[model samples]
Target: MRLSFFLLFLTCSVFALNIDISNSTIANGKTALLEFKKEKNISYEKIVVDKKTYKIFDNPINSEMSYVLLPISYYEKPSKKKVELFYKEAKKQKTKTLFFKIEDAKYKKEKIKVDGSKVTLSKEDSKRASKEYAEAMQIYKTTNEKSYISQSFILPLNTKITSEFGKARVYNDSLKGYHSGTDFRAKVGTPLIACNDGLVVLATDRFYSGGSVIVDHGQGVYSCYYHMSKLDVQKGTIVKRGELLGLSGDSGRVTGPHLHFSFRVGGEQVDPLQLMKLINKNLLNK
Candidate 1:
């Protein structure tokens, strides 16, 4: 009888821990931060939202709790999505689900009448693009156990945005797809800066992306720079916030000289500016 009573008390205490979204409702292309409290030492197993794995990490400076920055896709529809959190419970594990609501966001559509040859890929270019995409996707899909990224992310370019994220993009005469990254109108030699403190994971010129760079800033987060005039960093190089990366230029399928910046969380591409805003509030470096 005493053992049974003690177990009941333990169960009640463990279930008292709190885990909830900071915002109940958020616009598409933004983010939702999951804050955990009352549980000082816990291990997060996995977090799945809308069938996609979200990134989960412990606060580097604070050991009392952890956070998961749920990346809201820029094109996600206005609907309720289910989020399942698997976490440590006692000597075993437990699960919890939350219904997250997403709102629609109006996006601008733009058409570029670029050279037809630029839009249509040759057989050689197609093969190369396939390989490059495969490699990039691998980096996005894998999550590091430790957070490599520092505090809030900085903008790669501070100039006016020529194209916005989630914008419906039409190239030449056919639909290309939604613009996954924000574009900045830049000169051929306009310098680009690193978004945060991260390790250069991939730095090479691709068939479609041109002089490209991918930075792994830990915590299942990554930032990409595309269509650069030059490559200044190499693979495995650790960079600091606001460090010079390369120069912007017109490359690949673009119509003019510009810089493309994108952010990825747990293999999903999200709005870079939106990510910066979300990080500024939840995960700034101390």
Candidate 2:
């Protein structure tokens, strides 16, 4: 008699991953930009962009990179649009780059432009804004949250976007600027809500943000509400979802009453519209 033994082996296929771009084409006076970075050993060329978001029909003639799609804009000058790209591979890389190819409605390389009036900051003001931007980027580079899986992020304030994001802003009659956040047009003293279940990172008043609230929504995803009439939450306070955080008002550099709401996803400034879409798709529809 003889005894025999056999072993069975199985292998699982490993697939490469990337963040694809969606709806990248634009009109002549418009531009499309996608931010991406090189990952170790990962072919950037294998990355396929979201046609709806990226508008790319074929593969790039050159380069292999992993990229993240960003907000697009229409401008008048050839100024570089900037964004932060965070990558991790047993290590980390925090880099900023101008990534995109702009095309007209005719599909030609349109020259991207910028309106210099958007920033009317003095030397001192520029320094301060630069410092704040750096701190926010550091937070994104260190936070570990992986992706936008949360169903609905609570609104910083229960209100409508009166001014809209990225609109050409005119501060006072003399100073001109671009609106960095979506302005929720609300009545004075309207109750504001916390955008997420996170610890209060900053709660204070300043010359520009006026009475502002910044909450660290874990993973470097921070939400800020500004131009507040009142502040109910204090720094270091743990706020629950939909918690009463403040009241709306024309507190900061504004012409009328409104709640200026802003969001930072992994340190990149993204359109709040995406958040609404996520809520509708995952929360309401689900």
Candidate 3:
């Protein structure tokens, strides 16, 4: 899928900058790719979306083509918003704005009865959970200049999807939580693969997630694998896309054995399916 920034905003007023959007209608919890190329001696300093700044990434397919990626948070409301672009030409600073149509998306509600103890945590478990959450959040917020993932990603196992991202789960019809990851049905000892090339940031069994592995794909993007029966990789271990990481099982508070796979971008949970589709579209050049 070529992201043509050609003659964008034909129905709207054109900005003074050379910019084109990857899509006109962007759904919530999705990503947006911007194709941008600087004029001779004129380049952008930063790209702003919803008051947050983003760095420009070089298009791996075409060196001359630069792009900006936006990972819209699931909490973002549907509306028309403006993206600000700041650039400098011949030492002169300038800025331009582009509008995007964002739509709302709904997730499937799920209700499952699990152990009452799982829903209610003790004082010790609460403290441990808090610390673990903070650690994971820090990893998600970490920024790296170089993109560690260069190629396409592969599924951990070839199995049917049993659960989806953003799925809302109500435990015992009381405790509610959102399913921030995608789940694939896999039996015990099913070999799991790393989605892309990255260093293992965390590989340990926790209270809720059980055996989990979080890979830092650099550039504020991370992939997570949870509820594994066995983990082969360690912290700081570099893994390829198809490299074995572990096996999937019902080690956590799950009803059955499955691989709960997910991705985090810019500290927000996004749809793994949409993320993979956008990534595959970009990797078509390979």
Candidate 4:
């Protein structure tokens, strides 16, 4: 794990604020943990990064602390970025700016051969896929302020990883797009589990994803499981860590049976493994 810690102290009229960042430099398609602590009462306003505003949520384990997860998309430009933190103390508004470096991940390329129909959807199929995508995006746009899990995130499958995230994918000699999720090798009917405690926001088969499940872990963090053979959970069901989710198989636009796991933090698709490591090491372990 490549980890860097930074601490900054800001003196206010009636309180002192301490800010800690887990990583000083982050790669594209990765996440960083930002923590804030205060000696007295403080109201966190928001966090602005790369001209986008992210919500701040209270730390579940520590009442005096607040934190937010910063996600860098796979296509985000590699350069130095500024993060602005806004807060209120003693009826006065205060702000702080922090800088972090974003570097290219340099993901590998992959070529796959699946059914031609899956790549070129028909009119009906295209409409259905578009509707499904819009529904999923709606769920991701809303952030639950309260976190559901008090422990570190776990892997959905304990098997070998078949494909990594952020890989440029080509289907049938035509460049499609990048792989937005991590793929794990799983046989048909292989039972899968939830990575952490959360509410199942979406559980249904779609035109492109097939049998799919998405969980909201609160505070703008969501985990997605796609291309499942069967879904055991339903929408609005609350699940615990390591609970049964469904069975994995070759579904949707795929060449074989596997589990596709990914994450969205603050509406940005990120590397699931990297987000898990950051959450466990910087938030849960602290």
Cα lDDT computed for each candidate against the true fold = 0.78, 0.52, 0.79, 0.87
Task: Give all TM-scores, in the order shown.
Answer: 0.89, 0.55, 0.90, 0.94
Model 1 lDDT per residue over 11-90, tens place:
44545546645576767776677766535455676689767776567775566667788888776889988888787765
Per-residue lDDT value at 99 in model 1: 66
Per-residue lDDT for 187-219 in model 2, tens only? 889999976578787787754676888877653
lDDT of 1: 0.78
Q: Model 4 compared with the native: what TM-score?
A: 0.94
Runs with alpha carbons beyond 4 Å of true place in candidate 3: 1-3, 6-16, 283-286
lDDT of 3 at 220: 71
Collision pairs in model 4: none
TM-score for model 1? 0.89
Q: Which segments of candidate 2 are over 4 A away from where they belong?
A: 1-151, 172-175, 279-286
Q: Clashing pairs in model 1? A: 147-219, 148-217, 148-218, 149-217, 151-285
- lDDT digits (tens) for residues 128-202 of candidate 3: 888989989998888666677677777878889988887778889974767888899999899999988888999
Ranking by TM-score: 4, 3, 1, 2
User: Lowest summed-lDDT stretch of 10 residues in model 4?
Assistant: 4-13
Candidate 4 lDDT (Cα, 0 to 1): 0.87
